[model samples]
Target: MFHIKRAYEAYIDGFQEITMIIPKSNKHTVHSYFELIYEDNRKTKLPIVTRIEFERFIKYTVFTPEDLSLENKYEIEDEFGVRTDLQVGGVIRSNDFDEKYAYDGEDLGASYSNHSTQFKLWAPTASKVKLRIYQSHGDEEKFTEKLMERDGKGTWKVIIDQNCDGLVYNYLVCVNLIWREAVDPYAKAVTLNGKNGVVIDLSKGSHVSKVNSPLQSKYTDCIIYEASIRDFTSHPLSGVHKKGSFEGFHEKGTTYNELSTGLDYLCQLGVTHIELLPFFDFEGIEENNPFQSYNWGYNPLNFNAPEGSYSLKPEEPMTRITELKKLISVYHEHGLRIIMDVVYNHVYELQTSNFEKIVPGYYFRQDERGLPSNGTGVGNDFASERLMARRFILQSLKYWTEEYDIDGFRFDLMGILDTDTMNQIVTELTILKPEMIIFGEGWDLNTSLSPSSRKATINQSHQLSKIGFFNDKFRDGIKGSTFSVQEIGFIQGKLNHDYLSDLLLGSVGINNQVSLFQEPYQSINYVESHDNHTMWDRLKLSNGKDSEELLKKRHILGTSIALFSFGVPFIHSGQEFFRTKEGIENSYNSGDTVNSIDWARAERESSYINIVKEFIAIRKRFNCLRFSLKEEIVRHIKSVKVHQNIIGYRISGIEEIDRVKEIMVLFHNGLKDTTIDLGNEDNWEYVWDGTKHYVEKGIKAECNKLPIPLLSTVVLVKY
Candidate 1:
């Protein structure tokens, strides 16, 4: 049994340090022989010593006694000077040992041919740390165990020789006469529902190198499609063997491969990018499920490793990696980019987390009362201001980009990170991959924080000029039809329409001026994204009716306006097919029932799909529709006519001298059909009308007045 000789907190430069002592023993003793093992499978024997003194500061540490107490029992002294017992008595083992810090002069960190592995844990408060290696095949067998040696710092490391790669292991750490087992914070791999760590073959698969990727070309034209892996595949129409798995996306005959959901769908829809939801290792918290109590994958467990549930065969470690490469290749071949929606804001609150176990105070912010900050409302918020924490985030980004050939990243909650960190990341990422795209949810949840608390604060507004933001104002104005009084006057066909003109020219209203017009693609315009209510749901709320025909008309009008607006237009998945979430606004926690895109609706709602397809074609055909440059290319004829229920505007543009471009747009928001005058034009021609009428040259006589159906918009081109 280990006993603490002396225990007291010593403050150094606004940090606390904990020291511990353990008595040396003869047999099964603390000071006996031991070795250290690292990821490269290099080992070094521990030097025999009488006593070990472990000293560490709070900032850079990665281990906590509370996490280690899973196997061993321990005690903590409160502010009142009362000691409380903490439980411990499990096993702890390391999967990777940093050989560079070992006393042995060999570069053991670079070796990985043998089964031997090394583990390193930071336990500043532990009196002693021990390595427990269990027999691989035996039910209950004991093997050679050793007490970890402490260095100048409080790092505890041990090297052990194992029979094979799939052996179970744990760490036995002692704190205040209580011993417990703790899982390694840095374990690269773990067994499914098992206590021991599994050895992962990092080099077994073909790693995609960043140099070979063509991501540079497609990064600039990203139109991300955020989707869940399971929902995309589990649908009955998906038709793939590896359903709901990584391989399912690459499987032939699948919805994703049939050009129905993957590259084919994106290419046909003319979107340039696909941004997937969180794909990292996450816990599927069942209680939050909408249908059968399932998690939405927000509880991230590991940053570097992929989720096991998404893999077709978790034991075959390379399956997910290999399949992911195929998916990327398919998208790249079709001239489309892939972006990942990353969550570096906070991690799942697990006992074995790096934030909870090692350097807890350094990884997260603390309140005035010295409590963990919960800005994210998910138990804790990551302190991205910390250097080590920042490095970890950067490393994860680099690994995904360099290994998976991802074109860009869509940060989930970017405001959680400080401005300096974001700027540094942008600088480094741009230098590494010049065309890499970066954007995020710029709003910070914490209102109490300085500079970022205010809505569209001066500092935050300036940040938008540097990086792209989700243009919510533009979405609301176009979809909701509720803009400032100035905008209303313009849309109402009023004279001297400068305010409406500014909005029509792509102003998000936050800046009080037209900044987006300077670079149109910077404003990602959308009627609905994953966060907001679907366009149909919003319309239902406003209209208080569920008439399918009226909804279809509204959808057509919304799409036409969005595509014609001067910004990069984004359509949510299944919007073309008139997909609806049954009026559920916030379905982030909903299961497959609420989140799945109904492909059957596509066949039934063919008319809506056709309208969307036509609008997409029109947007692609005319560059001026989506043009952002501050140039008055289009000329307004200044001719307006108002019938009983219809309003019309006659606009024209000049291509060159002798070539005149003209179009007459009419909006009929009534129930009955009505005719409107086009202000005395002899050469006017009917080009497109929503009433299933397609116009051609010399088909109709010249008429200034045209009849339009109720609740429909008409566009007529004139020569």
Candidate 2:
């Protein structure tokens, strides 16, 4: 009489090595001989000669089962009275075994056509799988259930002869005799609140792909504006009929206080890219009262489907798809590229997610003791190293790019992902759309990956050659730390000449002998984004109850440095008008009071907005600001430290086709105004003075004795 504990078989060069974990309780009585029964009912006795003893169990390996096939369903019996059936997936985690051989199925979700619908699920360890179909999302009464058959690939599949369009479904999987119900991981659309996966024809035509955006030769040419779909138009004064909806984001010509609002305002701002924070299906926020709840859309529920809360009809599967497509088309038609801020790092709930429920422990990284890894600090980090996990991410990216015609992607917590996935994404997407802007927040997070593995962090940016990262060094060097309200940066009178020079050169290789990137385009220079306090609030808190005038000047100075810096420039939606969340550091889920843009405030701060708009025009007018190559940057740019509080730079080597031959930029962080002597004899035209700007013959170009206002940045051009 023999009993079995854990049995697995590994194949190497047509030879099978069966390993078994036998409990220490039966060690003395257990026999070294084992018998294997194949599907043909033929039994063969083998000797388990080698044994590695552990405190709780004994590991035994036998090399006699050389001709056993991986697909053969077999049984094992040992002399210690242990007996059990064998499974191919049981040995996938054995030491030195290739885990890549773990069985996977590509068509593991419902696939529908006009004539028939087929459903498949990859559950190697499960004894049974069933499909349940309902007429609609809410109609659960007397729904139909169909049995599925297991295939050679370990996938359970079924095909319904009739068309199953306009139906909602879920799977009833029986794992080890315990039944569990789950939604499809590859669902293209979901019902309200993500209750079930919906089946519908995705062939509905839209004009999203036909719209074109203004092209630039380099990634540095893009100036990104980040906004949330709900917060963008949730205010009552937003002047759009469909407030807090996708339609509102697409609405044009709306105004508040006689100033253009919504899409019209963005067009007026002259931004080249609009980065929307997480438009995917996210948890939380009741769809009934969308305005009552507010979120930055970081909690992702489904990677491929749009959020129902932002759609006109939350119940209909095709509603969100059509509306979001319309919104993208509208932005492209206005010559604006849309960048989606994707959050694939973690999920809202781990156990309930489709990825987890569909495949038990395959999608996430786990420790040796089988505990989930918390590298993202959000409980569970996705395991991009796994083949299926990598494939899922790559497939989702392709679907978005080809279906929606999106211009770019901003990955959230990108450092948690392995470098191989990021590089693979860039390689694949470039083939689809050349010159697409790709960047993200590559903060070094605690992850399971080793330090040398592919990471998208600032220190490891060279590994991801084409991807850009939000330059925290440039952010803190220009404005202040994102975490603290008391720490003041350069604009608040804490100037570091060496650091400023590095940031101005895009933090590229060796401008100040300390660089965070290999190329200028790899740095996204910004002082304010959606994650932290606005520049206005930072100055107010750190500068200590400062006067409004002084705060305004400091804010302008910070913006000037960011816009003028090398690499891509990113701005928050209302940063131009000094948007504030009432000193709240993390306003991700706060309601409209703290999250809305307050178009009224933007109206009052129109002067500052005008300055920012002018700065963008100036940045675009000069080719020196958008240099793409490292050699060009080193040769064309020069910086000098005039004083502890003053720094100046001269940018030359502009192409003959450019409007100006050379430009001088000066930054003064002192409390009082200062004048500097220009080394050159050529007359310098004052193109910008922080508060004012001139286009032609700006204030009579003077090479010597140039005055810069207190806490100001100036740009002078010379032909």
Candidate 3:
């Protein structure tokens, strides 16, 4: 009976062979041979069969079964009236199979030595492990040397006296009288993408020993700039050599300048953070070539390693790290914080991954039917609930913060992570860096994962306390071009009942207001980001007009509203010059053809840039505009009224006399001329208007009723 059970289980893949134990109590004769039948009606019987020893149980390895053929599918039946069906499937076999090759050893405390080297790897299943080191001068098999033996937990370590810097190495473990090869899990530097494990000397190449400079501040106050490294610098306008590489970020006359171009722009635009797209090592799924072309960097192969393609020199990994450090240093120098986009949701599904080669079932989430679930739109979604999976994510984040000097992280699709694990990580990260800006795409894409209780809402949705969310409501209301005039009228200072006010005042019609106040600073407010069309593009598509002046005014008004609104404001890069992607909203996988910002537009539309600059300066000048919601300083001045096309709102802080501090914003969307009644205010004076001609001093005197030209927005100060 045990032999039959083992043979039945052996049908599955990954089970190379099976051993069965038959009990002596079973009343069966040796002459009654085992008969097996497939689903196709094919039958076979064992010609030589014998009974086991007269013990309670017997164990022996069954003869290796024929490799499963596509035509083989059937049932099994024996003379003892035992019968079962054969189904093609796979399973992970553990007890008899030893997949591990290394062991966990004593804690080798942090080291800074140049000549000495330490190695560590985790292999819980191995009984004995040997470290094989190859001499640098010859074939690996010719000059082999055993360095050290593994410890009790299956970890092996060795520190050689010779300069073993660039040596190729592998672990050979003896399991059940068989020896197989395994790669060292903890190798800092690997060769041939881990096909042939090689040791690297950290002192060589561009590895820098000094601690990286601190970021400007925590990322809660940042305005993100999401860009692909390759697409950002490969164009002729980029003007850099290590084009699209990490070193290119330091190239004097390229997009790095444009990256910093928005520093003063953001400082004036009133933003505190800059969330960069994924900078981790990833393959280009766009062009299919792993070495070149544009990719969002989602297919992560190595968690600890940087993307080598982003380095000027592919042979040197240290150069990538050094260049990234310098980029972070420069952002820090300019008082701009950096938040990296992290994708630990899944890994590339190629042949060279640890998850694919060993213990595949342990890494990914399985469906109810016992198949891997591909919910993340990638090949598979990681099961964060598993102990090993949880440790991998946490360790990766810690390595980035401690090694790369990252200010914070924006998790991509954080909802896939288990609730308990997400909370644990939030707590750990907060403790590590109290002000770390942690946020994620809280909504899950899979219907099975997204329960009614788990769906994301702006302020009330997240399970983690310190982590903020990207408020999609604010994004939709202000810039979701599909909204009708009625909707716009409800939000843009019309329909005085204030529907937009509800969202603005921290209640976005969701549950659990308690979490809303826990950290409202966690919310990122913006009309546009890298994922969506530029606000300008949306406005043009909605209004059906190409009026440059009107476009400039609308741009200023949208940016001004975002800067002065409640939560931290984020501006997509190139928005200051009225950048347009020509109305392509979902350009995620598109090539450089559709996504690149036209730098020439800035020169042609200098007036638009000046308007944006002035609006930013205005936002910077007034504390009332940038005040936190806790201040409770906003008072609705009901004296101002709204007409068919003109709308006005008054905001006064604690101070009233300072011209630079007090602000009254009046906006006109009407096509025809209309007079706006200021309700007899005594000290109102014209401060700034969207029109380029308004910058001149005497222009205010020549206009009728502040002369708000068609589709113009104006800002005034109480003298």
Candidate 4:
């Protein structure tokens, strides 16, 4: 019923003999000679043509090369005398160009010198490329355009021997005679909202804080606190000098209700690393007045550049970079590490995105119908398996670690990425910093890539040995399903307490046939994260009839289990004080009021905060809480059959214990108090009890029977 209106393609196989392919659908329609027109107004007639079958709907007619030499303008006339501009479509595949014309240039983006600046772009198929440089901002009248030369490696390069420092620039790439402007993908600095790439000497950003991140030997040793920069100080009571900026994180002595806020508050809480939500240059927030807009920064605009919206001076790109460095520096000075939340799985826009604008259909994955793939639940999943895409990701990670000195990375929707790319990242990053923590949401998403191809899910966790996954099993097991509020977890009267034993052993063991991780370090155990409802809200929704006392008990019980687990423990910011999003489940764009931490509640509920602090101290004080190897876990840690609702475990063979030769961690989830029978009841001593309103010293046990109050986690030690 349909016929090809017009088709044009050029075959380039060393240029010795070039052919133009005009594919027609419904070949049953007439026939005629194909004409070729050159830029010099010369016409070449192709009297002879060969027909070939190309696709189901298309029939290709090939025309011999007309000996046209380096011509930019070309038009192909079909049998119906309809002339169309020739484009390089089926003439080449994205991967073919990637493999054949891979850019071997040592420097990417804008590499600068005192007298000259070289700009490079990897657009192998671009017919013609030009570099447009502006004299200054708000001055469109004065600018210069320079023609670029293409190398065999497919890189387009233009050198400006004059000083182009502080000048804004963009690339003008032509495809099928259609020109498109694109921001540099390798740009280290960009204008507000990524309008253009700025030519600034990166070396000028030399002034940096001397502070270093807190040292961590292993991933399990970290107690991570997840936070959003905007939400941290956007609260009206935050009292920070700079509200909703990287500078706000450095604000000292800022407090509410006589309690410390910002970095000072985190110090008091004693978390080793602060995993910040994405701060990379992302779309959505207007840079000029960023406080008016709030985002979690998952919509990545520029992977390597720091977000301008988070900087005090959004106009200056270096400030965004320098300010973020200073913020990390301040955290480092206070013995804290910063973990960057990276979103490389998908981009916000398709056509408008630089990945598309520069290389068209090359950067993204295509489905069976050749449409953009949406595995991340975001519109387009990045084709990380592609050569250039993988290279970009690897380079971006290195930039963040080396430039900003980030101690860790939290990849969002990491399962959308292929295992090969993830393993390569681990291999390279491990060499750079072996101690650097790398973890992410390894959720299995149905992507264009089949299950066996790319998924970095928990089932495939063995492949990525060094990387870790956010233990959704631990998350759901401890605080119920994040999806439904009515669904209760282990702490909230969910009967099957047997699964808690699996989690207590870090969700993996030699005996555990149904383990989620190959090693304990691969599991990032947590009850609440930035993605879903807070533990308080989940408990509130699930247990509506439960009193405030029971709700608080449930909250503490969840934290206790996660903290005691043999994995890298993670907590959402303000989770210690029963943080509530006012029942808003997904607060990604719910504005400041909906997402800001309630410091007043923190002060009122200081006891619960004290409970979290005490747990952190205990985890730090005892080597038993953090087992180094899987063999040690199996040999030393074992589950005890205390009760159906009680999850109990014992710690032995720990040489670092000064007072306790045997340690027992027991959790009582039942509505009534439960009695635990310690095998060595006579020698057992009650070292710590969660039922106490405040943290206190060890109290001597009665020795016959250990009575644990309902909804409380108790610890006992025997010397």
TM-scores for all candidates?
A: 0.69, 0.90, 0.71, 0.91
Can you write out model 1's per-residue Cα lDDT over 268-339, one digit (the tens) per residue? Answer: 666666777777666653212322544556777766556566675554434555666667776677677777
The worst-scoring run of ten residues by lDDT in candidate 3 lies at 101-110
The reply for model 1, stretches above 4 Å from the true place, is 1-190, 193-199, 207-220, 254-267, 285-293, 350-352, 447-449, 453-461, 464-466, 481-504, 508-519, 625-719
Each candidate structure's count of clashing pairs: 39, 10, 17, 0
Which stretches of model 3 miss by more than 4 angstroms?
1-6, 10-118, 123-220, 253-272, 285-292, 350-352, 447-462, 481-497, 503-519, 536-541, 545-552, 582-585, 627-653, 656-675, 684-687, 692-719
Tens digit per residue, CA lDDT, model 2, 148-190: 8877555778998887777788888764334678777778888
1-719, model 3: which lDDT tens digit per residue? 01224322213333333233345454642334545565666666643233355445543333325543312344545567665544323323222222332112223211224566555444433334566775542354555656454444334556655555666666665422234565553344444333335555544633443333344333333445555556555555555566566666545534333332223433443445567778776555322233334556777665666666665554444555567777776666656667888887777772345554333355676666656677777767776655556666776677678766777888887766666666677777777777677777765556233343443323234455566677665566555534442244222323332434433433222222233443345566667777767777777766545576656666666665565455566667667777777787777667666665454555566566666656556655655544434334235232235455554456664364344434666556555555655444545566676365445332332223455655556777753
RMSD of 2: 4.0
lDDT, candidates in the order shown: 0.54, 0.79, 0.54, 0.79
**Winner by lDDT between candidate 4 and candidate 3:** 4
Local error of candidate 3 at residue 651 (angstroms): 4.4
lDDT for each residue of candidate 4 in 518-589, tens digit (9 for 90 to 100): 789888999998878888888888997899998899889899888888889998998999999988888999
Clash pairs for candidate 4: none
532 in model 3: Cα distance from truth in Å?
4.0
| Model 4 poorest ten-residue lDDT run | 10-19
Residue 619 miss distance in model 2 (angstroms):
0.9
